[model samples]
Target: MVYFNERDLCYNSIYPHNNSWTMSRIELDACAECDLLLTPARPAVGDKARCPRCGYLLQRPRKQSVARTFALSLTGLILILPANLLPLVGIKVLGNTRDGTLWSGVLTLYREDMWAIAILVFLSSILVPLINIVLSVLVSGHLYFRRPNRYLPYWMRWLQHLEEWAMLEVYMLGIIVACVKLASMADLRFGFGLYAFIALLIVNALLASCLDPYLFWRRIEQLQHNHRHEN
Candidate 1:
């Protein structure tokens, strides 16, 4: 069952469904854009509902979306180890070969006194992905355990905001471009870490792209409600 206090949404006291004898919770929600009262239809998997007034997408119930996201997040998290620990690229310059990990790039930048770029690279390329993986695990694991963090709503919202700043995919593209430019001058070989980094990039992209705020709130509500009753 879904429950929301209208006051939280700046309700106008307009009761479109004023009729009595309601068995369900009315499936009511407000559009974030226009505050239109929307009673979402029970959509099947892969189906979407749109608000009639403003054409905003109300809901698209993707089955196992949370599970899929969790799996990808876990995979990306595992890849982070190899992505940083193993060598990412092997450059053969004049028949002398050397490989470097992601951290090595950051260290190189730091050694050159390019602190700003080095920090940016470390945060966006490494720290951001780590945060996303942790957030996904924490939130998704809470839901799985039917437990509530009490501040999970705020935590989840904060995570969403942080997600906007992640640049792992762009970082990967930069790596690809760099390799392409150096291909003629040196025989470039990808290391195991590079392969892991690529996989992490793909899953991280999917995790960020397919996430739905509405669905997240809904799941949080369910977990919180269940936890309260269990007390």
Candidate 2:
């Protein structure tokens, strides 16, 4: 991927690589992530393009992408309770066994005076996931409804902000590391919450991958534009 100035992208797209190419086609597209001007090319259904500089997905048109993302977001949101309330794992230590849910673990930590770590764990693992799921649903809902939204930019920015803090991947890595360390120390058992967590990660990641912010913004722009014309 090549880094491109937003100005250059806009300008070059107006200019031409060659007169013949320009004469034949004149559509210009911008990379959502980098604002790199891309010559528009019609792609097959399964085709996808990525920005060379940022590896940001440029275009990947699909049937029902917004609908699918909305569905996935709903599924993830529904799983939130199971992922946190059910037992994440059962642990056996010195012949004593106990099953621990996320809240249970947090309570245990708090009781043990590890409030800071407990808070950190709860926020990253629980709260962040919830916010990400909720925001995803909202974003996809807007696309699905295609309503006039004056706060489109703010909505997208809010989602992006929440996205940066939603650390399910990091928390999962921490869990894996902890599991490995505890292998020899005790008998470890995976539980419903653990499975739910895994599923949540899969669904949320899928939602993120399917969502194209650029497409979202464009849709919003079109809707607002149409609304204006109607008015």
Candidate 3:
């Protein structure tokens, strides 16, 4: 039997042992928000777990999470090059036509001696997004194929931390703001790159939705444990 202590914020499990009962604390799960120790009850498919004290979402398992994430991440990778290299928008001001690509934007900032802003934009917009997609593919692909990699834990850690730095949505918002500002002054034309960029953003969002960090961590642990036993 398992019971929770509301005052101490701990879950204790009791087991029968030779005409007696042994009580032990279960530390398998911890609430990410309130730091409450818990032995989480497994929720059924499409169900979720929440922290009792803080009301923070603890876990929500998705069906075929690994396969879904891998597919979306791979699609994002394929879309990224065109999203960055091709012209995103074209503008005509008094017969002077100008096309803007993501790479060109960063280079323009650098050429204007705004090196710091250029670097920041480059990292947040282009580099970080690419890294996140690649890492997602690597992690999900390995798991989907049942491959036990020693570096899986490290990859997952970096993926989670770097998620905050990938500002694709922010960049998209900036693009929208620029378009709105430029509409009155110039004739704006959307390009193929804009469509690809939008698709990439959608795919990234889907990938994030399909990934279950807790499930991935548990699977990784099981994989490594099984590998150790086999060896």
lDDT of 1 by residue, 77-184 (tens): 788899889998889998799898889889999999999999998888788778878888777767666678897787687688788667877878888899999998
Cα-lDDT of candidate 1? 0.76
- C-alpha RMSD values across all candidates: 5.7, 6.1, 4.6
lDDT, candidate 3, 144-204, per-residue tens: 9989999999999999999999999999999999999999999999999999999999998
- Lowest summed lDDT over 10 consecutive residues: which window, candidate 3? 1-10
What number of clashing residue pairs does each candidate have, in the order they appear? Answer: 0, 3, 0
Q: Candidate 2 lDDT, tens digit per residue, 83-190?
A: 989888788999899887878877889999999999988887788779878877877787788866677667777887778777888878978898999999999999
Clash pairs, model 3 backbone: none
* TM-score pick, better of 2 and 3: 3
Model 3, position 160, has a per-residue lDDT of 96
Report every candidate's CA lDDT: 0.76, 0.76, 0.85
- TM-score per candidate, chains pooled: 0.80, 0.76, 0.89
Instruction: Tell me which of candidates 1 and 2 scores higher on TM-score.
Output: 1
Best by TM-score: 3
